[model samples]
Target: MSLNFKDGRSDLKRDSLMAEEQALPPSYSVQPPRQEAPEDLSARLARLDLRSSVKNGMNVSADQCTAHLKLLEAFNQLREDIGQIPGLFGIEDPIFENPETPDTHQHVQSPQALAKVRVAEKRWSVYVARAVARFEKWYSTCVPATMGGAPCNRLTGNQFCTVKGLDRVAYHGLPIKQLTLPDQLPPLDVLMVWHSYMLNPRCFFEDCFRYGKLDFFATALPWTAIDPYIDIVTFEFKPSVQAVENFETSTGLCWSNLNDGMEKTFSCPRCLSTISVPWTQGSLWTIANEMTPGNGFADGDFLAHCRVCDTKITHDYLRVLKFKADVQAFMSPSDTPLPGTLLNKDGQPGKLTVLGSPPESFFPNSLLNAGLSHRFLLLLDNPNVSMSDVRSIWEQGLTDKNLVHKAKGVRTRLLPKERLSIRRMMSRYWFNSSPFALDLAGAVIRQGSFVEKMHNIDWLHSPALKSTMERLVQKYQRFFTLMAENPGKVAVPTLDVDLAWHTHQLNPLEYYSYSDKMCYGKYIDHDDKIEETALSDAFTWTSKAYADKYGEPYSECTCWYCEAIRESHTSKLDRFFKPNKVQALEKLHGVEVPSDPLNSPHISAHNAVRDPESEAKQRVKAAELDKAYHKACAKAKKKGKPEPRRDDYFYYYAWGYPMYMPLYYPYGVPVVGGGGFYPADPCMVNTGAGSYGACAAGTCGGMAAAGGACGGGSGGCGGGCGGGGGCGGGGGCGGGGGGCGGGGGC
Candidate 1:
């Protein structure tokens, strides 16, 4: 009844031979509407999966109840008018299921479900009142730089969002909304969405930073391992290098995972504590790769050579880095000055001059023989990041493989299956389609390479990439032709993104990892060999200190696997959990490392309360404490910020304070007030979340530049809420797959 794999081709067998057999449900008669509301778990599950049956909008799992709930919440928010306080907020009956009883569910369609949505304009007012209270209070102490409706400020705070008119047509034909968020979310949703997806200052602050509507930023696998070692550049790439993440499902941007130039978190293997930073793109630089401006490190070559380790970091291991900057501006440009605007191009804000002569193509022959995604795949696996071997493969594509045996593009590889795996990863890699990374996407994947078999990636960039890159030659003057460059000597530009390569030990796979090509069956092992999996748990955090420091500890963990285990347990089995206790995530993605919560001391907390109902919910929770810890720890290491509570659970309380943002809310008290917390620095405005609107004044997002002093300053006095039902559903608040991988099994 299903497809089968044969000779690497997807083939399916059909049992029915009739050419046109129209099928009809045996029970098509419309069942009378239930007179009463279904309150049991069985009823709830039947109602849920029936809705889940909708086609096309898949969330990679059948159990997307929370995502659905979040979506419904978003819909309720949207149905209400956020422009006025009276028109915000709403809610509906929570949907759930229990294995104890699997039958008798009420299958409610959208019309029925929408009808069930209860819009309490009063309820929304309560939420808005609370938000306004906090927001207005935040405005009293500092200023906000609002541009295009999104604003950032130490007082206004980092990543607080409001609708600037995504619905309103801009001069350009593009939509106003940038990241994945529910349609027409209320003011609070906007605030959380902005912080969760854009400005997460939690890494440095203790529990003072809050998460957003969506959880991707928290579990964005890449940052887990990468964030601990890098520092986000205050400035973007030189006017158009582009971002590394696509953030298509959500309108947001992510930092790069490449070792180009960011912070590096290297540690002394013996002491297992923080070590002196040897790399930085700005000012201080001790890293060998950083010292060598254009010549990036050879891919397959990195000697761990930590004075304590005194050896190679090994091919199986990678030292990753992460840079935390507010990249929301890069999603779509605002009404900022163009000459001054730097968040464009294919990659980041930096410019990549191919130096002398850009090769007409890096691997022409290999490219001709292989798929587009495989091109970047080859780059990830290559021992040397140079272009010589790649050029040789292009030349050999017309001849034989002997002369070009080096790790050329997929075209020249002996293990074509591995090539396919890399190709597949590239097709779905999160950062491929963001407008910022379009050119780099072109560089990574060839046109037509992902036809049908991939995530249906965009191919429109090829021609544009070629055209834009072509201008670099004329811009630099006399750089020969694309093919005339010296293949043996490649010139790499400095991006200050060098931290991308260092492993933070969080969810490494969440960001991206380079691995050798292999068959699907073997690829898993190869992934393990590269061990690019995210490292969570206190151990990894203790060394690099990531995710939610001092918030919640992974219950069990000797290695990073512990966090993954927790994520799995929380996702699908919350019902089975014992009340009021946490679960340990003792599983891991890689075999070599023992990153699991079972080995941790915190497991005792959850073990005393485990039950069948909560089995799955625990797994989805790993992203919380572990994920945030890595990002914050890495950021702290980069700036030499004092490291305090990288592992304390109490820290999560401060995230709601507005002091952290200066562009929009623009206010907060010193460390003593506002719940015993303060901003990282007064008006520190260049993080990716704080960048776009943090510097602009009288913009759609705010009325003043960050730190410039807002007129209605209300310094930390927030509104109160009268809880009740939310607005009707379908506001798009929860449709963005914003839920945690909160329902997985161990």
Candidate 2:
């Protein structure tokens, strides 16, 4: 019986069933029943309500419960449908997030991302538009009924509260009483629109003007930032005629007249014909021709034509006539009525009228000359020019011969001490006790040194010394006068005399310190011996001991002489020792002074008055020589030949001076030139032992000039005087009536 399980009966049943399924029609084989339409929503709801009832202290109904369940099921189905759509539900979906594939966690979009970003934008835009429209409508018309009846001003919260004269109440959590809106305020979404529109800077003023009076918010607007615009508009518009007239009337109080009945007279330079015209009836012209165009009352040249002769007259000449008229008006006011006045002091009728002339003419002259000093008046009038320039020009004018002679007369009449006292007073008062006075005092001190040594007199008390100082000052005054008179002349002799005077006063040893002197004096001849040991002993034993005992250094013994001396040292010592000074001094004094102490040629002082006449002759001769030399040089140049060498001999004799020495000298001599001391003469060569070589090349021009006399002739030997020879530098006789070979001791 078990063997029959694997039989044909099972196969036959399966085949029959398959044949039956295959033979049936597709629609008849598997058919779904049609679904009835859902019960009408209102009918269903009515039935649910009718079926619903409360029982057993519980208000429960099957129908109502069923309806609620159905509603919940429907809601769940709706949620499912929404979730099926892209970007609708779940953490995987997003509506506003970017659709682009993102790599970072923050920028990552949901897996169920949307393709339409503009759709979201459109939806938001629709919301904003609706909100704005609602807000605008409400703001335009809505006003709190509680406030006294008035039109809505469409103002901001704070402005609205202010206009209503009501205190604002708080809203939400923020205590914004100033901006607390009324209860009838629109929704926050709509209010946001109004806020944005009001706060926008571009539209703020425009909205204020359109919705409310701008005057109410004038204080709130930034007036300063817009003031330039306001000023532009104001200037562009013209004021009324009455306003202009009022302004003119108000400003006319200060006006005064210039022209009267008295006519101004003008004299033409060409015709020499005088013409009279009214002072104020002329036209002014600019000096630059291009400044004005066309011929009219305003167009003319600066020079005016004479009415009778038609001759051009300068404006300056016209101004002179105007000045005379003004003077006459001031003096005879009754006749002219002071140009502008209609009534005199006695209340009488006036002659003429002019505007803005009296103040312009009268004030300047009267105030400038109102008992003030010339310097003060100059400072007041010409503020641009400095006081020093004015003073210099003034002092130059004081060099007039008549003024100088008068000053000399006054000085010569006074006693020497009285003259000194006056000079000191003048130095202190007129010179303001300034550095200029100090320099003048220094010059006097240096000049006085010669007289002091000659007469063996104390500079402080000796009347002779004071007189000598006055004479030196007088010499400088004369020099200034000569310079002022003949400024264009070359080779001024007064300057040479000044240089000689300065040279005589110079002492080469004055600049060195005691230590330097002791070190360097070993190489030069000196009147006093200086030893290094002695200097060291003085510095160490005396200076330290004095400082330890007195608490201060001995300043006078070792310190610099004066500010002037220090300045001189810094300036360079060769300035005092120029060879020109040596030659000039020899010419003036008729004696030889050793230029270099190492070259101990017989040097002596002589008593000789400096002949100013001789110096003047020499200056004239030098100028002629210079002109002739330049003419010769120019002729040579024109002929395409080399320029001639300067005649050194002629220069020395004619200019009455020598050329500069070679800059280098002995160790003790200051190296004050461009490089160092240089011996100019071969005979004066430095021997290192402080001795100078003998003159193998004979005498220098300076020696010959010193020995020559004023008149051209040799002197005969008498009373220890040698025979005078011709001057060695090409012209003149020996100045001192002595020959080089004579026993009188050349």
Candidate 3:
């Protein structure tokens, strides 16, 4: 049952073969025959008189038959020669003439039979040895020219054989281009050759990085040959100008145009009074033109003296306030204002810009100009963070209003608390603590009071206040969850809230689906046309619906409502629900169900002269029966049993296997305490069984199968075949084999 490659028997066999060849007498010595050229052998095989020798049923020439008989004779001689060698094959047992009917044979063992078995085993060993020698010779010839005659030094992680020759080395059997080496190549040349070989046919190198073990090799051979040396050296390489330009084009934005001068509002540190400061757009220079005329300072070092209280406010404080300020009001017209604002210091309105009022009109282009797109892309690319989590942060940080407010508009009326409570209870299961806690459901319940107030209160409509509340709610939610999980050791979730805020401020649409909320249009009065052909081209290329809706050669439109509508129409649910729902309904009630279920002529003709109520009842009954039939079929398919007939429905439901809902943890915890979160049904929880006991009772079987077990568990986890206990038991939990607890045989 086991193969021992390190056994000394192979060494002994080699020694014996060498000794036998050496001891042979000069006349008895066997000489290898001269090899014939491939062409000559092919010609001889082609000339064979195969047709003449096929008189019977055998398709072979007389000469071939004669050669086969000779070969048999030689094989018998070889077996005899091997039998003469002592202890080559282990001791053999006697052979029975009738293996199937052992009782028919005599009880006495035959010495001759044992001898034959020993001879057979010896013959097998000799055959294997010869085959190995032939294969090795063929392999050496197949190796690359650079390593043809060289001894194999090592095997690479990718399984290629490596050999050194002169100053260079080659990997044999690897599907790479052969390097053209000089008679005397240096180490650097060898390195270059290897680099070229690794990169040959560009796609090869890409494939290696994407899906192969080429990343394992790092250094020059004979030094550190199992790691990626080139990658390590160039790991910190900066993007070239061309690369930057390519990135800009890909994102549909121009980096240089983001530097246009803009106005920013800053707050005084002492009195908390606000002031307007003119910034040289992307230059990082911030100074109040009226307060300190012609005095320019780095944004980081810029300080402002309060007009009333004479308090100096640093740029850092001002930056924080700036992000927290009301986006609309901060950019609104003001006396003694910044240059980028609609109104300058003299009270005259200024020119419109990308980052100005109605920022959503420019969309992705405006976002890129503000550097929000770059941040969002980076967050999206990170593996450690979840996209949903990043999206939540981005939405909160950037948006002026909550999603509900944006989607539904101003709510003039409010539902009573009692009515709202029932609706909330039906739709959402509110928890006291974080859902990530070990408990199946947390203790806290969301009263929806704050949400209701926000919905009804027209006075609480400041965009700044909404943005602030959004951030506070998110923070509070995360903090509550962390506190519940660790209690006394609560730690804030690691996140760059400020960065998320900046990203959101730049592009609110980054984290929202078009259907989720609509973007409000620009508020400014002026029309400053900035050509966005690239944006249009990108939108057209990326979205088929956009192209179709706008017509060919579509250009980016500044109409926010149109874009929002397009996005919402093409949302996830819009794309999938109609087709899937239709398919399911058709499979249940027949194809006619969709076009005209109530007034179909087919239904009317099928039940001719029947009353409308009776027909309706019959249709309902038929639908129920179809569902039951499908359910039975699906169950049979899963259990690998025969399908049940309609007549057997009662018997099947009463005595067949119990149907259980798939295990799930809505709170996100894989396991709570010592058990798993398994509800009685999909929506109802089983409060009687403890978490650990539920797992033991096989409730978390599906969870275990989905890699949700506490330890390394594979195989099925519950009642089906191959259901091994998720944590420690072997085989399936309730099956005919090595399961945790079952009535089946092992």
Candidate 4:
């Protein structure tokens, strides 16, 4: 199968049984049953109430009782504020003056209540300050300033810098040396090998949300499998702090034994543009100071791109080495940098300490945070704006900065109606991490960007965003071959039944070694393997590594960063499959919902009681670049003027797009100006590395579940693999490989 890197599009037909067979995925999606909770339940909750989860979530704090009391007081404070809003307006009765109130009330801003609100505002600030302080304090407890094996370059947000050389930082199963063992490799295994190789980064993101390997996969990963890991440690301090010491501690590296034994390798120069699989052996090898196998691959073997130098090296001269470092950490809650724990250096970390590195913000972290940081601030800035209007404002802001042109290409070719199901059927289409993850610029806004001052992803790489062309070429090849053999048939990528049993995953502390005796042979010749990992919850997410490093053993989170969220969306069966159908039937018994928000026919009567101005009143402006981004969801259900721009290939994902979540757009791609979206402003672009679509980026502060690891927040590096599988030529994308994009340096 020839894997073409340039614009490889699928040729499979949708609705065809053959395509259906090709597109079927092992069931994975398991969404929350639509529980009809009272609409007022959310309205009654206060931000203070949510913050308590962070405190009382674990037994670590002995004052659960106190935390509860504080939270309730916060809640009462909110209620009082609501009651006083009318009084502040000098109205005798709020309900009588405004009988047509929208069921969903937004954050109420009563500047008139300024005199009465000061105390609460101050308290809220204090609470936030303490949380930030605790996070920093707890962080220093585990990380060292000069920590080696830090998850990233330590310079850019979401970007990881290679260990200066290949040998020193082969975190994945990348063989950094130039030696090899002779053997004939299987083609299928080769494909599988590439898939596993790509899984390194994706699994890293998954595991972060998943805690570690225990919860990530059903089985434990080999103790030393070179699984990819994201550096999750970042800290910030107030301006008053005279000195800022960003600390990191790590102890993962290989020296003499691994480095000296490694041999140089070469491959087709086009490998840069090709998908590499282990199906084939090294064209050449040298061991024991002798030329072994055939001569190594020539200069045409591959291209090595240095993200930092922006330099490309021909494969002919690519040689990487191994060098690892170990460091310890300690942080002080007070202004002064507490003496570091390492006995080697006095207070400072590492052998070489650079004085005056300047202060970096831990909360508005530029190192690892994805989209949540800036979008959260957007909400704070535009407390009055409706969700949809905020999106419009945000999008338009990007246009004013002239950043949308890159993304303006029509998504007509990407998952068009005729190909929607076909694309969905593609076996390797990973949704959470594919283009979305690679486009970390869209994930969160970082500090220190001048061109993109709003929310920049300066370290993001175009190739990385595209998963370095890894899965893209592979999927294209499969689709190409399938099209050649079956014509219009697109096959669904099913999971191995055994995947549920072993549930082994690629985690940073471990690498996956395909057990020969326990092979994933479900997809043998002419056989369809249906995986049941999601359906069966028999396995335990037990991990000593996670307990020591993070805390929880296993947790199930449905948020954007959740690996379960990433995997759940992988299968078509999961996408359209009916779960608990029998239960649904028994409960409904043909009863009709008179006012289902999701039901189409009940719209007329539903609107009669709805507030007409609920949306407009909610229209608040977004901070950073003010692109009317929140217009869509603003109780207003308002529509932005349609721009001349084209929707993304995956725009329809928005239909089922969770209401409160934000959507980060593709990287290197600029937003186009026009209608059916925000105006053609590009300030959003200049505002950051790439622009984050308003809604997807906006709705945040959602509680992070115990097991959730993949959201932009980094306890570790985070980004889903490029595709949700279904790589077979679905589009110019691949799933797995490179979690949501980090900074540019690789």
Candidate 5:
């Protein structure tokens, strides 16, 4: 009974099925329904009135109320000032007073004005640092004790797990009852983190709405209570007694005492039984060690053992469960009944009532933050997909087509088109690459870490703080430019640049507008969960690109000795063999290197003191040099030649010997004589490494003019100019005397 396998009837049947599939509506065009996002609360924030929220049962003190108003005033002023900086927020097109014959260089302030701004900025940074320090302490220990069972609940779950959405209810998942704001303001430090978090308005709003944090979201920071200080070194931040009490009462733990021992306990995913594991303090072991397979909160292999379920809980298993849950929530039909907790407009327990659909009534967060979730759903459609397969999809890069091909149902047809259409509709959040949990966690950790790092290095308190900030601003501008140019590529920032970036994100409303207009027609979202290898690769690329575009080293040592060594072109070992050279280096720079120079402090320590007389002399000399530079550019422009390149008309810092080091360009980097995007001209490079007062070298005109005395040319170590000079790049150009100050022995 051999049947004819090549039957015409079979071919006809297959063709009919193919034709039917083709005739069906393109699934890509039919996007899943997503509710419109709520209007921005910029107006409400600008003219913030907390009377409504304050009436919600929390007792408010008269003193506290007064304090909050004052703090709010200061915060608003700071926002206004930060907003005016053109490139600080994002790339701003040159605004022209007159459309015809506009001055391309008009956007730039004079070098003197720029210097004043930088100085003011340095002062503001001190307070910012203090606020950040407090925030870190609060965030690390703010876990509530009612999370799981008694013993397991006292400690915070894995910081990484909480961040990655594994422990969904920790930070974002507080019970509905504890959602209201306390009348007293949180300590300044806690407020700082909150302030920065809110500045990322979209992220903050979505998080609150998703987690039923309506009351918290409506509350405002008590700006009036804050004491703004200029000096970071002496400024002491004291959270109000009421504020402290409120925090302690709510969390059932001491805010000051965060030590919970070496091991943290949590509940098993499968069983309700508590599981204990070794814990490290910082989130994801980022502060202690690199994330390897068996390190802190390792997302591979066994997480713990569950005795009740007789199940070995692995990271893979937890992720799978979470992913499945997330997918189900994301695919929920619009007609599904709203949760009773969410339906209560009054936000009172046991007072739920059925109401018509409203703007705030919908809970679409899973779909709103569905990038990874949607992608995972497609993979799960394949019945044959294994745990390894899921892990591979997330860990490795796969294109859209490849992802679609892996799915095994009618959903595959709908997803590709649906995702694309949905993305277009929700253009504002198109760049969000991870779950909301991961994004929130990353932003919190990075911002807190940066502020703390800045404070520890004494950058906020340094006498050379202005100069340091000036350089940071420039570097940050370049960093943002790189991000705008290269889409979908990770770019790691230096500590200085990262500080500036964080500051910009603090004002979320303005940031959104600026980013949308300037940065690729959408907001550029920050992601902290990028693989270490990818971050390294991005950093290496960033360094090279930055150097090429800006013609300066992207990374520089802030240590005095290193700067001295690099500037002088002498090795550290030179102190032993070429003792005279080392002595000259110290004398020329006016810094005393210690006997054991193994651990060096920041260069700012040596360069903090200001010499009024020396500063005046330098300013006078700088004025003369600045004129000469402009004259060179003007002469070139009139001759119909290219305006003198910014690289030309250098402000040379020369030692008594025949050494020359170009220190600054008073005018910003303009391509033509008066065109292009010009940044604020940096102040004259202060070459003195001691007291920030001594004249380290000669000026372009003469040694005496530079406030330095000419002497027998011997061992004058070079000091690289600070403003915009190519640090540690060009070779030294020597001129006349050894330097003004007499040589001191090393």
Candidate 6:
């Protein structure tokens, strides 16, 4: 039976217990493994309790299925590895259940069910750090400072590599051995960018078709497998010699020589003349380092004035111009097939298709939306580009009716919602691609920075780190639920939850499937650009809503107000604890006693044991207690008859007290100056207390249940009998009593 202490009541009943006992199985024989059962509809609906319509839009494939399974296997191995890390608390599957709640209530995940998610979140930082390092190494190795006779840098090189990797992932002409499988992933850098892009499945699908990377879109990256060979601590991995050689051959770039520097030479966007920029970390006024004005990539404000055309040139502007030309080709009506277009046997143009959907079906509508993005970028690049000019350029492109009319006639082939959704997603793709590419470049940079902060946190060594991570993961789930329930409303996450969310997104295929099911058929997008005031307001709303739903403070704080509240709650729970004589011994004995079962100020020993540092201290105290108890036991053994067996009532009444004391001693009562034992108070053996039954009127009939309540009691104290002066008597059968109001008894 599942126990829930949230409401301080048990689901147990005398009649139900008897019935269950009577219904026990006849033998201890093991049964055959059960077949996997389909998920209940009610459980799925409960998970999706969102504002929008629920739909299953996940595109599954053989590769994705294999990758998903492999990823799960890798995750299990990673979890076991993490568990073995020294100084971490051993894994204890804490049960969380409220059986009284309705079926529609969110079903709490079992520990095994939640294990993979936690592992993913735990290793999220490692993934980011490794991905960044991999990208850097590959960029330094294969891609140059310039590509395709155009100006390029790490930023541009990343974009080129992403497309190239997509090309490899989608290529069907390759031999079976050469195919990019779950085990054979693309270059780390390519995988990282591609992973983020896939977070928006709708956009990923259309973009894949746009570049003819249908295979790439269909096959999900085995994210857990990505870091299997890497060290979680250092977040490092060495590429195999064959893998390195493969990258060089595929890209036609040397892998050995490393080209280093920020200096970039590129053709000016307007002048069509070569311009060399000496990029530096400083801005205009910091010229002592020989830094050029308007050439500050590191400072995040790089722009150059073309002397020939007087056009303001930035890397963003250059990228926009290049992208415009690429998209414009889709509408050019050219006889030459585009990059992703399939060729016929005679080398003639075959129909452009993505997973069987004709590209012409939505080219006009999609391109028109792409124009919307292009216009936005053009205006953003240089305010001098008039809105009228952008509109005129866009209008001129639409003069061709062939692509538009053809798309209109293909209505039967495409659903209205599907076509509109594709167009909307393509528009979003354009919107994120320029200026910031928040979904692409921005995600990499932002998540990478956050991961650095996560690494600095001593996750493996710290005592509180495990619980801290658990809290963050819990909040992460709630944050997503909030977004799912609210739809378009803004919701801000605390830094901890943000880390968890970032890691969740890293496994794009799983995230996509999860969001599709949970968020009402809508992929909840993470908006990293909320205004300060708006973010603050959203956080407040989040905190209030979180408290209302979860019945706890949204975020923890060490501030005075929060501390005061914690203390208040702690004081109220103190009624459940037995009066600890360990505190009394601290005053009597000058030597320091270790913090443990009774000596520690916490109401429960479990709380003291939560921190590794605290638990280590508790161990020493426990050993000291053990030594003292055995010494007293040896002294008693000389008398024979085992000194009349110390009071069992002491164990019955003390809730959360350490029951496994040496020689059956209740508390860690210290030996004062190596004399007689400092006698503790008499045991209140009151019957009819809620938990396990206690002895009645000094009778020795009952025993306290391990990890169960001692229950509330009144004054029925009996004097101590032997050890010191008088040892308290054995316990009684305190049946059907008022249950422990606070902590569980010994």
All candidates: TM-score: 0.18, 0.13, 0.14, 0.21, 0.37, 0.40
The lDDT values for all models are 0.20, 0.23, 0.22, 0.19, 0.31, 0.31
Better of 1 and 6 by TM-score: 6
Which ranges in model 2 have alpha carbons more than 4 Å from their true place? 1-383, 387-746
What local lDDT does model 6 show for residue 510?
47
Expressed as tens digits, the lDDT of each residue in 139-250 for candidate 1 is 2221122222333222111111222211111111111232222222222332322222111111101011111111222222221121211212111111112222222112
| lDDT, candidate 4, 283-343, per-residue tens | 2212221111212111113334434333344321221100000000111121111111110
lDDT of 3 by residue, 1-746 (tens): 11111211111222221121122111101222444632332123223231222111112223332222222222233333443444332223334455432121343323343234333332233222222222223223322322222222322211111111210111111221212112111122112222222211111111222122221111111111111111221221122455345434443333222221233354454466887653311221012111111111222124456688765554333322322221222223321111111111111111233222321111212222244434544543332333223323333323423432332234422222211111111111111011110111110000011111122222122222323323322332222222222211101111112111112211111111110111111100000000111112112222232223222111112122112212323324533644543232223222111111111101000001111223344355445434544654664467585443333111100001111112210111111011111111111121122221122221222222111111112222211111211112111101111111211111
**Segments in model 3 whose C-alpha atoms lie over 4 Å from true places:** 1-241, 245-324, 327-634, 637-746
lDDT score, candidate 4: 0.19
- Deviation from native of the Cα of residue 727 in model 2, angstroms: 36
What are the C-alpha RMSDs, in order, of all predicted structures? 31.2, 52.9, 36.5, 26.8, 27.0, 27.0
Query: At residue 440, what lDDT does model 6 achieve?
Result: 46
Name model 1 segments beyond 4 Å from true. 1-421, 428-432, 436-746
Candidate 1: residue 273 Cα off by (Å):
56
Return the lDDT, model 5, position 359.
21
Best by TM-score: 6
Ranking by lDDT: 5, 6, 2, 3, 1, 4
What is the RMSD of candidate 4?
A: 26.8
